[model samples]
Target: MPEISRFLGMIIAMYYDDHAPPHFHVRYGDREAVIRINDLACIQGNLPPKAMGLVIEWAMAHKEELEKDWALARQDLPLNKIAPLE
Candidate 1:
């Protein structure tokens, strides 16, 4: 997994494993969730309440970049650098 962004101690990463969708994994402490790229919604697992809120907010703010990165990742190409979110 390559970390692409971080916020509120929640790390957003891309995982390269067969069968995994083009999504980002959010991790905070022991909590984790796989957020789908197409919809920017949590598809699997759970995250801490505050972490989840922050993740959702951050994802929404960076949806465009996130989707673009996901596409590049799916093609096994180098990811585009995303600007840091406030």
Candidate 2:
């Protein structure tokens, strides 16, 4: 997993070995979630409502970069930059 960004102790990352329509992991304290990139859906695990909101906001802000990274992921290429929602 590559640490894409961090905020308020929350860690956002992407796992190259992971599958499907591209997604990222959000870890905040003991909470975690696998969020799909295209639709911002929570495909697995759970995340607190407020935290999820923050993540959703971030994802929206970086949609373009995330989509680009997703394409690279499909090609099995390394991601040079994956910006977080700032």
Candidate 3:
């Protein structure tokens, strides 16, 4: 697992050669979210509403970067660190 971004107590990460649909993981406290890269939708897990909103907002801003990261991950290559939410 490699962490790509973190902000507002949330940790966003991705795994090398992970499963299908191209998704990233979000963890905040005990809450977790698996957001799909293609559609920016939560495919699994759950987070607080406020946390979910923040994650989605961040995702929207970095969609392209996220997709690039996904590609790198799928290829078992090094993942770049994305800018944290500001």
Candidate 4:
């Protein structure tokens, strides 16, 4: 997994050659979720409401960057570091 961003104690990352629907991984403490880049849906796992809210806000702000990172991840190329939520 390659970490692309982190903020407010949340770690955002993507795996090389990962599964479809173009998503990224988010980990905060013991909670984790796989968030789809297209629609910001939670495909798997779970997070606290506040944490999830932050994740959604951050994802909404960086959807384009997330898509680009997904493409790079699929190609196993270096992923760009996205700006974290302030």
Candidate 5:
């Protein structure tokens, strides 16, 4: 997995040539989740409430970038780094 953003101890990443539905991986401490890019839904895994909220807020702000990165990742190209939530 390639990390594209990090904030408040949360790490956001995506895998190259990953599975369908366009999503990103988020890791906070030992918890993690796969959030779908389109609707910002947690398709897999789990996170704490505050962490999940921050993830959603950050994802909403960088949804477009996430989509673009997903496309790049599908091609196995280097992904662009997105700004972390302040």
Candidate 6:
């Protein structure tokens, strides 16, 4: 997995040639979630309420970049880093 962004103690990453529905992985402390790019919904795992909200907010602001990253990841290409929440 490659990390695309990190902020407020949350780390966002994606795997090369990962599964369908185009999702990214989020890690906050011991918790983790796979959020879908199109819907910004958690498809797997869990995160604390605060962390989850922050993830959603960041995702919403960077949806297009996330989608582009997903495409590059599917092809095993290098991913571009996204700006973290201020």
Best by lDDT: 5
Predictions in order: lDDT: 0.76, 0.82, 0.92, 0.94, 0.95, 0.93
The reply for model 1, stretches above 4 Å from the true place, is 17-21
Candidate 4 local Cα displacement, residue 81, angstroms? 0.3
**Model 4 per-residue lDDT tens digits across residues 1-86:** 89999999999999997889999999999989999999999999999999999999999999999999998888889999999998
Top-down lDDT ranking: 5, 4, 6, 3, 2, 1
Residue pairs in steric clash, candidate 5? none
Tell me the tens digit of each residue's lDDT in model 1 across 59-78.
78888888788777778887
User: Clashes in model 4: which pairs?
Assistant: none
**For every model in order, what is the number of clashing pairs?**
0, 0, 0, 0, 0, 0
RMSD of each: 1.9, 1.6, 0.7, 0.6, 0.6, 0.6
Cα lDDT tens digits for candidate 5, 1-86:
89999999999999997899999999999998999999999999999999999999999999999999999998889999999998
State every prediction's TM-score relative to the real structure. Answer: 0.82, 0.85, 0.96, 0.97, 0.97, 0.97
Where does the lowest 10-residue lDDT sum fall in candidate 2?
77-86
Candidate 1 worst ten-residue window by lDDT: 14-23
Model 2 off-target regions past 4 Å?
A: none
> Which 10-residue span in candidate 4 carries the lowest summed lDDT?
68-77
> Which is the winner by TM-score between candidate 5 and candidate 6?
5
Candidate with the larger lDDT of 4 and 5: 5
| Model 4 lDDT, residue 5, Cα | 97
The ten-residue window of minimal lDDT in model 5 covers 9-18
